[model samples]
Target chain A: MECLEVYAWLQAYLDSGVTAEQERAVEAHIRACPYCRRKLVAMARVVNALERTSDISPRADFTRRLYEALEEEAGHPLAPRPREPRR
Target chain B: MDLRLLERCRQGHLEAFGDLVSRYQSRIHTLAYRMLHSREEAEDVTQETFLNVYRALGTFQGERFSPWIYKIASNLCLDFLRRRRHSTVSLNAPIGPEGDIPREIADETQLPEDVALAGALGLDVQRAIDALPPKYRTVIVLRHIEDLTYEEIAEIMVLPLGTVKTRLFRAREILRVSLARSD
Candidate 1:
């Protein structure tokens, strides 16, 4: 496989989405070509870094703040307001 | 989608809407944060997303809830980015005496091992992502971060499937070059 073909299939190869025949071709190219192999490894590292990155949570009071904003937007208490003593 | 919860939400149950908010708040917040790279703005987007969802509940006709909510959150994030384009700082801007990129605040809930691993490389990866153009950034975030399918990304972005795939490929290529250079 040429360099362009290798680039074209690199993602699919990493995803394991390529067919067995295509995989073999790509693998053969990588085994034979040092430059392509380094490129593949670097690309794989990028993918790994991305996949391993943590999914961050919002701040601790996110839920409370969100509810407060929602209530304000709704123009009413999210929960029923306490009734005044019987007039 | 909890049909019962959705039905209650559609019927004007505030608690049910709150339930939906609690269920999706984290994912929505994460998407917003990744897209905009600002906690304050991400929080704003998350809040607005649920509010929009609440208002539009009546119009929802039993379509899948996750993608619908994601669509709203993504649009809000995009709008925020567009409005801030003039003032936005490059994520690669040097920080500290050694000129390292700024690290995102760590998530306490993440696994210790993952957090440690991330501490080493996460900031670099984030900088690379932030350097991407918005179109490429959107696909990368949707696919890698949110784990959405290309089809779902197309629907959310209102683009064709082929466009989504092509954009994603281009995005990865850019990421690859950027990451390689950083190393």
Candidate 2:
């Protein structure tokens, strides 16, 4: 397959959405081509940057504020639903 | 099976709601912040999302709750971005040949608090995400930052599955070129 075809498949390839035949072709093409490899790496870096930040926190009083808002919206307290213990 | 909290939430249980909030507040807030690029708006969206979730609990009959909640959050984010859009030529105009260029009204004001809360991204990478058009940025943020599948993204965005794939492909290439140029 041409580099352009591989370009079209790169995202799906990373997603593991491509067929085995298409995957092999992409692998073979990347093994032989530096430019496509660089493109793949660039996309990988961008994805990695996004994935690296998984520990984002909201404000300390976020739950308090939400509960307050819910109460205010309901104009009264709603009972807490009983939770089942995890097995 | 995974929607146990949602089942409790359906009964108007405040504690169940609190537990639910604890479960998804960070994720919902992160998604909003990534989409809106503003700490203030992210907080507002997070607050509003749960409220809507409470009010609309009857509508959620799905087996899994994440996609449903994420759909609510993503919709709220889109509405905010739409309202904030102004009539300015965007800063990140196309560098490649024309055709699939994403045109967005620029909202370039990232406050100190915004940067303070931004998780692991350096300024340049953040700017690259900021520079993308809203549609592409939404796809990138949903797929990459939210770690959502293409099907879930399609649902959140209310788009066809094929459209989601097309957008993801285009968004990745655009980011690749933009990040490389920034380097």
lDDT of 2 by residue, B60-175 (tens): 87777888889899889978866765444345543335424533434456677757776867666666676666778789888988888999898878899999998888888877
Counting clashing residue pairs in each candidate, in order, gives 0, 3
CA error at residue B103 for candidate 2, angstroms: 8.6
Q: Pick the candidate with the highest DockQ.
A: 2
Query: Model-by-model lDDT, in order?
Result: 0.73, 0.77
TM-score of each: 0.82, 0.86
Fnat per candidate, as a fraction, reads: 0.41, 0.68
**What tens-digit string does per-residue lDDT give for candidate 1 at B1-183?**
556778997677767776776677777877887777777898899989988987787888746788788888998987887677657654443245543333343323434433432323476676677666777778888988888887899988889988988888877877887676666
Model 1 Cα shift for residue A32 (angstroms): 1.9
Task: Name the fnat for model 1.
Answer: 0.41
- Please identify model 2 stretches exceeding 4 Å from their true place: A78-87, B86-111
lDDT of 2 at B60: 80
